[model samples]
Target: MRIRSVVDVKTSLGESPVWDVEQQRLYWVDSMDGRVFRAAADGTGLETWDVRRKIGSLALTANGDGAVVALDDGLYRFDFAADRVELLAAPEKDVPSNRLNDGKADSRGRFVVGSMDTLEASPSGRLYRLDPDGSLHVLDDGITCSNGPCWSPDESTFYFADTWTGDIWAYDYDIATGNATNRRVFATVDTADGGACDGMTVDADGFLWQAHVYGGKIHRYAPDGTLDRTLDMPVRKVTSVMFGGVDLDVLFVTSMARPPLPRFPEDGPQRGALFAVDGLGVHGLPAHRFGA
Candidate 1:
């Protein structure tokens, strides 16, 4: 499928493309700048909210009241109407050297986020799950960088990627309990191929679409871990992807820009821009929201 720029925004780190189905808008984050962006399907009505700290990720609340966001230390509740952000938890308050990274809400409505060393010095990252009642649970540890995290359309599989390890892992997910087990490697790609998987989403037919940060492309893989197709992008640092638009048939993508150097020196000015892939003949399931 051909991916073309839908939004002119070029962020230092653009990630987390989530569709607000009811509002008919797209929400995403610029991680390095701690900015949350919202825009209509046609790319107009673009508005930005700067939280003044590095924001890792965010999920819409089930009631559509606000969002639960992962900043430097922990999760917070961001009320768009009031322009307020209240702390939900500071799980890593003691680890000032670490910062939260990619996160998403599970089918059970729990926010699952991961952490990474800010300096990229050691493999000290960790994965956490924030429940509806504001309790945080540590699911795994010792990750260098956390990136992709998405549940299968059937809610039976959980997938995550450790960017530094160049491996994507899958788990047998218990949707009712928010438990992940039977952890196994699902796919592996070298840095030379992509520099690791960044973010992902599953299609209605059970295929996974993954963004490749270093490769300037998006890879579509069957649930069995076989590559089905690839969509070449104009930028190298493709960060995340989600299906949006009226029928959930448009694939919305985000990317990151490399300072001083154009992220897509060969491809010209489309680097770090948001994209929309249409006419792919596939739709996606709705994103799950945080219960609280």
Candidate 2:
């Protein structure tokens, strides 16, 4: 299928694109710019909130009252109506080089977030579970760039990526106990500079759609880790992707403008543009906000 450019956000580091079905808007973050953006499904009504701290990822709460934001150092609740930010947890205050990266809420409404070093130094990032009562549980440790924590459609399996390793790992999840096990390699890419898999989503068909950063494409793989399809992108650093739009058929992609190599050209039309591709009538699960 062909992908189309929906909007030009020109975000320096656009990442974590999530579709809020109830509001008919797409919420995403510009990491380097430190801005949170909400745009209509049709790419209009583009409004931005100037968050002073770097936002890693965001998820709508179960009750739909506000959103849970993965900030630079901690998790916070963001009230859309009031436009306010409140702290939830600060697990790594001592580690100045580490910051929250990608996070999402599980089916049970628990926020799962991961951290990484801003300088990409050592593999010290770890994944944590933020309970409803504000308790943090460390799920895994020794990760370099915690990427995706998307769950399977059945909620029985969880997928995660370590960007520096180019390996996507799968874990069996217990929704009741908030536990993960069976950590196995799900997929791997060859290009070392692709930055591994950044963000991902599980389709209704039980397939995983992953954005290959620096690889310039989104890879669709079957539940058993078989390559199904690849959606080409114009930019080299694709940060994340999610299925949005009215019918959940539009696959929205977020990209970054940063290049690790100094020789890469900076000026390009596709760098910070949001892309949409038809997923052949496939639909996605609506994102659940923290609380109404």
Candidate 3:
């Protein structure tokens, strides 16, 4: 496979990467900078928006008019044309130490997001679902840092990660009611392989692609939770992954540029830049839009 950095811009703490097939654009966030960005598949015609608060993730609206974003303490709707951000819900308003982290939209258009303890020391974070009706529901709890929220192709299984704990979970998902149940450990990140699991996406063939934050690698896992293969990246802070391109056959990755951690201080010069991996002989499922 061929790998290369796609964007000139870098981020302090880049996290989520969402691909919009209709617009042929990629949307992502620099969590620490509270900035949202979009660009063409090849990184041209870039645009950015500042929400003035830490943004964990964002999802395209079904109508393509705006995005539903997980910013700091709550979920908000951002209107691209009007340049306005309206709060949708603050389910954790009472928990000052937590902030919404990774999230994605389900096939039914419900946004599934999770929270993280700011200090990454406690299990105060929780998983939440924001339905299209503007109602919020709690799905799971006892998490320290949340990441890698996605689903299988058939929409029967939900996958999520608790980064601080080095675990990825699989849950039985109900497409009709947007509920995640029967939670169980689907996989765990070997500290030797990576510092932690950050973000993930499932491919068209049902294999899961995971980003190894400190390991500088992207791993593919079979449907049965077995390691299928691993692809090395140039950067050590690989944060997230997605699929985008004219034919949805390219893999887009996001990374971080912040000061190195004590445990894993080494990093590539291209850290914090966006990357594209092509010619993998694999395609991805269509991205789900919020309220679609």
Clashes of each: 0, 9, 0
TM-score of each: 0.94, 0.94, 0.97
Give candidate 3 misplaced runs (Cα > 4 Å).
259-266
Ranking by lDDT: 3, 1, 2
* Deviation from native of the Cα of residue 146 in model 3, angstroms: 0.7
Q: List the residue pairs that clash in candidate 3.
A: none
TM-score of 1: 0.94
Instruction: Report the CA-based lDDT of candidate 3 relative to the real structure.
Output: 0.90
Candidate 2, residues 1-292: lDDT per residue as tens digits?
6677777877888888989877899988898777888898778899888778888998887654578889997899887778899999999999888999998888677888899988766788899988887888999999878987898898899899988787889999998978988899998765655346789998888888899887787888898998898876777778798988888888889987765336444646778888888755677776655532
Name the runs in model 1 displaced over 4 angstroms. Answer: 259-268
Model 2 poorest ten-residue lDDT run: 259-268
Q: What is the lDDT of residue 9 in candidate 3?
A: 79
Residues 1-292 of candidate 3 have per-residue lDDT tens digits of 8998989577988878999888899999999899999999889999998898999999988975899999997999999888789999998899998999999999889999999998888999999999998999999999998999999999999999999677789999999999899999998777776467989999999999999888888989999998899998998889999998988999999999884335556576898899999999999988898998
Q: Is candidate 2 or candidate 3 better by lDDT?
A: 3
